[model samples]
Target: MRTFFITALASILTFPVIAGTMDIRVLSDINLSSLIVSPISGQYAIMADGQPVSDSAKANIFQLILEGDSIVMKTLEKKIGKFAKVIFTGVGKNNIIKIKSVVPAGRIRSYDDHLEVSVYAAYMKVINKVDLERYIAGVVEGEAGGVTTNEYYKLQSILCRTYALSNVRRHELEGHQLCDLVHCQYYRGRTTDADIISSTAATKGMVIVDGSLNLITAAFHSNCGGQTVNCEDVWAIPLSYLRSIKDTFCIRQPHAKWKRNISTEDWMSYLALKHKYPVEDSLSFNNAVSFGQAGRAVYFKDKDIKIPLKTIRGDFQLKSTYFSIEQRTDSVLFRGRGYGHGVGLCQEGAMNMTKLGYSFKDILVYYYKGVHLVDLASLEFFREE
Candidate 1:
C-alpha cells in the first residue's frame, strides 16, 4: 500500500485538485468459467492483444472464456477466436459497461464505468475502473443497505472513501487497487438509489483521518449491541481513535442480540480438547460454564484456564465475543450481543443518530474519537490516477 502525508495548507483555494480513480476487481471471490460483457449505453471500444478490434458500436457484447493460461473473448451470438487480453473502454463519459456471469444463473451485475478483464490463476478477473465518488455510492448501497436518511448515507460514504483510499493497494499484486469482496469492501456496482448517490456526492472527497491527519481504519459493523469495543481488545492493535464507547442507539435495531444452543457434552468436550480445560473438576467447571458480561470480556475465565472470548466465538460460530454462557439441563446456551468484530462505528447506531437529526460529521465524531475530515483533493502528498 502507498502511504501519503498532508501538510496543513495555508488556504483551500491554493490546494491542487485531483480526480480520484479506482481499479477495483469485481467478483473477485468467485471463480467463473465465463462471463458476458456488453455496453449498456453510449459508445464502447474493444481492444485485444493491445490492438483495437471494434469501436463505437450501437450494440456490442462479448463472451470471455479461460483458455489454457490466457483469456479468450468471443461474441455471444457468434463464436469468435481467442484473445490474450481484452480491454473494454468507454468512448464517451456516458458509456456504461455490464458484465454478467454465464456459468451461474441469476448472476448479473452492471458497472457505470470501463472494464479490464484478464486471466489470472486460471480464472477471469474483471477490473472496474471508476470514479471515486461513484464507487463510493455503490459501496454505500452494498454495505449500508438502503439507509433511510441522507445523513447516514453520508456517514457511510465517508467511511467507504476512507477505507478505499487507505486500502488502495490491497490487490495491487493482483493487478487492481481493491477487490469487490468483504475482505476489501463489499462493492456491487453503481447504485440506483437516488438518495445514496446524492448523499455520496454531498460528501465528495471527504474522508476520516486521525488526529495526526493520517487516514483511520474506518472499521464498522452491522450493530454493536449497547456499546462498542476497543480495537486493541479485538485486533490486539491499539488505535488511539478506536475506543470503546456506550451506544444505546442500536439497542432496538435488528441484529442486536442473538442466541445459540449446543449440547452440554459437546461444549465441555470442545473446551477440554482445545484448552485442556478441567471440565471434570466440578468447582472449576461450574465457574467456567456460567458467566455474565455487563461489558465486553477479553476471555472466559477459569482459575487456571483463560480462553480468549474470540476463540470461543469462532469455535461455536457465535455472533460475537460479547456473549455469556448458560448451562442448561441438556444444552449450553450462548447468548451473544452485536454482530461482527465490534470495533469502531456501529452502523445501526449511526443510522439512528441520523434519524435523530445528526449530521455525518457528528455521527463520525461520536463513533471514531478524535478524527479529522479531510478533503482528498487538498492532500498535497496524495496521488491518484
Candidate 2:
C-alpha cells in the first residue's frame, strides 16, 4: 500500500511536545468508524484515555487521504497497533451527545483507554497540515456510505486527536519502541484504512474496562483447557484485570492449515525432542498440569516444574499466562496459549465482549475494578500559557 504521512512529531515522547504546537494533515485509506466516540482519544480540547487531550499534543501525522471510501496512511516506521475514532459532533449546529444522561461538549473516549493505531510504512515524507485537511475534505465530498462532507470534516478533527493520543502512548508511556519490532506492539496498517480505522471509529470511545477501574489488570490466554484459568495462576497485574477465560475470536492456531495425521504421541515427540528437550520414553504431556493436580514439585529431566510466584505475577506484559507440562502420548508436553505476558486487557477477550450484549463499558468494568466517566470539557480550564 502507498501512503503519505505529514507528522513531524516523534512517535514516542512525553506530552508538552518540544515544539510549540506544530500541526499537520494526515492521509489514510481506511473507512473510519465514528470518531466522535473513540474512548482512548480526545481532541486538543480533550485528552486521550478519555481525559482532556492536552492542547500541546499533536499527531505523528495529520493525514489527508485524497482518495475514496478508503485512504492509506503511511509512516516512516513499523508499529504494532494504534487507536483512533471519527468525531461526529460537527463544529456547530446542535452538536451534542449524552454520556450517563449528561450532555457535554461533543467528545467521547473509547472504553478502557484501549485505542491502538499502527501504520506500515518503513519510510515516508511529511506534508503540511492545512493542505492535508483540505485534500481529505475534498475526497470525502460526495462518497458512498452516506458520510456527508461535514462528517468528513469532523473526521479530520477526530483523527487528528486520535493519532496524537497514539503517539503519546507508543512513544512516551511505552518508551518510544517501534510497535512492529514484534517485542513491541505490532504494526498492521494505518488507522485510516477501511477495515482498520472505520470499524474502530464506529465504536469510538467504547469502554473496554471500567467500574472500580482500580489498576484493573485482568488476564486471559489463547486456549484454556476448554475452561478458564484460575485467577491467581494467570494474573500478573492486580485484581484490576483478573477475569476468567474469554473467547478472543482471534483463534486460528498455528498449523491449522497443515494436513497432519500424526498420532498425538508423535506430535509430542516432535514438539519436545525437536525443541531440544531431552525426552525419555516415560515423558508425558499430562505432566504439563501436574503442578495443579499434584503437589510434590514436578520435574522434567530433573528441572523443577514449579514456577516462582513473582515470575508469573503482577505486570509481565510480554508473555502468555496459559502454560503447563502435560503428559502427551509420548514425551512430556510443555505448552502455553495466549499472548501479552498475561497482565491485563486481552485484545481477543475484548473482541468477544463486542459479540455479547456488553457494550465497551461493560467489558471495561468486567475486567478492571473502579473508575468513572469524567467530562473532558473541563479541560478548557487547564490551558498552558
Candidate 3:
C-alpha cells in the first residue's frame, strides 16, 4: 500500500497543473451610461451584493445602468437596484457571456468565464475573471491575429504568457490584475481561430524567463528592417536577454520601408525650436541634417549637440530611428526602415522562420538571447494547493 501511494504521488508531480485563472479588467477606463450583457451559451446565475438574485435564471439578456452613483440591473423590464456589485457566473463549460455597451452602438464583446461589475459614479466598471489559458487564447489572437502559422502562434502564446505573468499585478490598485488595453495586453474577448486556440493550448502555461528565473518583457514589433535593437536603446533600461541582432527575414516585409518628405525650412525650424540647434551654422547643421545610416545610429549626429534618434523619431512621428537624410531641391527626404520600437522579437521575421519550419523554441532563441522556456504550471506559485 505504501509503494502504491508513493507511485501515485510521483505520477501526479510529473504532470503540470492545467487549471489556473486570472482577473482581467475589461473596458476599465471607459465610462458608459449602460451596458447589455447576455449569456451566449450554458446556464448562468446573476448575483447582487453576494446574494443570489436568481438561481437558474431563465432570462437570456440583462442590462446594467448607472443611476446617480448606483447600479441598476434590469431584465424583462424588472429592475433591481442599489447593489454594490453584481456577478454573472457560468454554471457549465459551454456558458459564455456577451457584453455590449448600450450607449455606444455596436460595441459588443464576449467572455468565456465570469464577469464582475460595479458602479462608480456614472459608469460601470467590469472585470472578467477567467481561466488563464482561456485568457491567453484571446491575447494570442489580439496580438498576432489569425493569419500566421501554428508555430508562430505558439511563439506568440509564450510571449503573451510571459508578459501576463510578469505584469499580473499592474492594475492591483484599480481592482483587477490587468486591463483589456494596449496599456496592458490587448485582449478582445475570445478567439474563434482554431490554430490560435490549438497553439495556445499546446503551449499552455509556458513562459520565457531569464537565467535568474525572472520573466522577460517579451516585447515584439511588426518589423525590424534588417536588424533588431537593444532594449536599452529604446527604453533606456538595459536588459541582457534583449540584445540587438541582425534580421534579414523581415527586410522585404510590408512595414520594412517607409519615407516621409519634410520641407527643409520646416525641418530646420523644428530642430531650432525643439533642440535649440544652430540651424544658421552651416557646418554643424549640415552635418546633422545630411547624415546617412549605414547602421542604426544612437544619435542623429556625432557632434556634441547629441540629439537622440529616439527623440527625433518621436518628434517627427517617424516609423523608426534607422533612417537616412537626403537633401532634395526644396524638401529633405527621410528614408526609414522598420516599424515600431525595435526592442525584441520581430513578428514578420518570426512568421518567416515558422514558414521555414523552425520550431517555436528556435524562433524564440533567435530573437531573445539566453532565455529559457519555463512552464508556469511547474513553477511553485502556479501549482495547485
Candidate 4:
C-alpha cells in the first residue's frame, strides 16, 4: 500500500515496477460442492496437502468434491485419495486450465496460472492465483465488453489496475486478495480479447492518484446521461477527484436512457409506509407524481421531506437516480437517464472519446478531475526525498 506524489504540470508519470500476483476467489457467489478441472496449456503440478502427487499432463483432468470437512479428488477412471487441500501449481509459462462446476451445473471458464482448492465451511472453495496483468485484463473484459478501441481499453485497464491494487487486501481474512464479483471487480479468469491484453500491457503499472498521492476510487459506470455526479451526491463523501462534470460523448449511447412504470398504488404505498410521506395531502400527491429532474437532484421534490433519490432508485429497481416522474392512468412513469450510480468515469463516454481520436490519457483526465497518473515505484522515491 504505497502512494506517489507528482508535480502539478505533469498529467502522466511513471517509475519502475516489480511483477506480482493476486489470489482471487473464483465463482465466489456459487455454492459449489463439486467441480472438474482440466489443464488447457503448459504444465501444472498437482499437490495434495503440499506434497506432489502427479503432474497435470499425467492426470489430464481431475474432479474435486466436498465430503464432510475434507475435499475428495478423482480422475476419469479411478478415485484419488481424499485430502484436506488440493493445489495446482502452475509450472513454466503459458499455464492455463478449464474449470466447470458439477454440483449446480455452472458454465465452464478458463483461468491462467495456479489454483488452490479446499473445503470452506459447507462447500468447496476455489481460488485462482494469477499474474497481476492477467487479472486486470480479465477484469476489464468482464466490466466493459463491446467493440472498443485500444485507447478505451487502455483507459479501462489503468482504472481496473488502480481499483485492484487499492483494494488488494479486501478479502485477506478469507485467504484471497479479491473475489470474482462486482463487489471487488468483475473478473472471469483469463481474457481472450487480444486488444484488451495488449492495452493492459501498454498501460502496465499505471494508476490514478489524487494530489496528496493517494489512489483514487477509480469508479466507473455504463453511461452518464450527458453529465456525471459528484461523489458526495452519491456516497455522501467529498472526493476531490470525483467531481461532477458535463460529458457529451455518451449522449446517444445505449443505456443512457431508460423508462420504468410503477403503479400509483404501489408507489404511494411504498412512500407512505416506508418514508411516511404525506400521501393524503393533495399538494404532496401532485408533487410526487409530477417530480422532474432536469439535472441530478440529491433528494426528491420538497425541501422539508428529504427522500433520497438513491433510495427511490433502489426501491423501484430503477437504472439510475437521474430520472423524471410522470403520472399516467394508474401508474407513475419514470424516465431515467444513465445506467449506473453516475460517478467517476463513464465507460461509454470514454469509448466515444477514443473514437473521436482522444488518447487514453485525455479521457482519463476529462472524467477524473485534478488527478495524476503515477507508477507504483515512485512512492518509495517520493518518501525518501
Off by over 4 Å in 4: 1-19, 55-57, 380-385
lDDT of 4 by residue, 1-385 (tens): 3332335223222322224788899999999999999988988888998787754456788999888988888898778888999998889689999999999899999999999999887889999989988999998899886688888889999999999877877897887788999999998789999988998899988888888667789999989888899999888889998988998999899888999999999999998999889999999999999998776788995548899899988887888899999999999999988889999999998898899999988888899999889876565455445
TM-scores of all predicted structures = 0.91, 0.36, 0.92, 0.92
How do the residues 260-282 of candidate 2 rate in per-residue lDDT, one tens digit apiece? 12345654454355444333534
Candidate of highest lDDT? 4
Clashing pairs in 3: none
The pairs that clash in candidate 1 are none
Question: The CA-based lDDT of model 2 is what?
Answer: 0.30
Better of 1 and 4 by TM-score: 4
Name the lDDT value of residue 142 in candidate 4.
Answer: 94
lDDT of 1: 0.81
* Candidate 4: 10-residue stretch with minimal lDDT: 9-18
> For each candidate, what is the lDDT?
0.81, 0.30, 0.83, 0.86
The per-residue C-alpha lDDT of model 1 at residue 195 equals 90
Candidate 2 weakest ten by summed lDDT: 1-10
Name the runs in model 1 displaced over 4 angstroms: 1-18, 55-59, 76-80, 104-106, 381-385
Kindly list the per-residue Cα lDDT of model 3 for residues 217-292, writing each as its tens digit: 8999999888899899988899999999999989988899999999999998988898888888889667756888
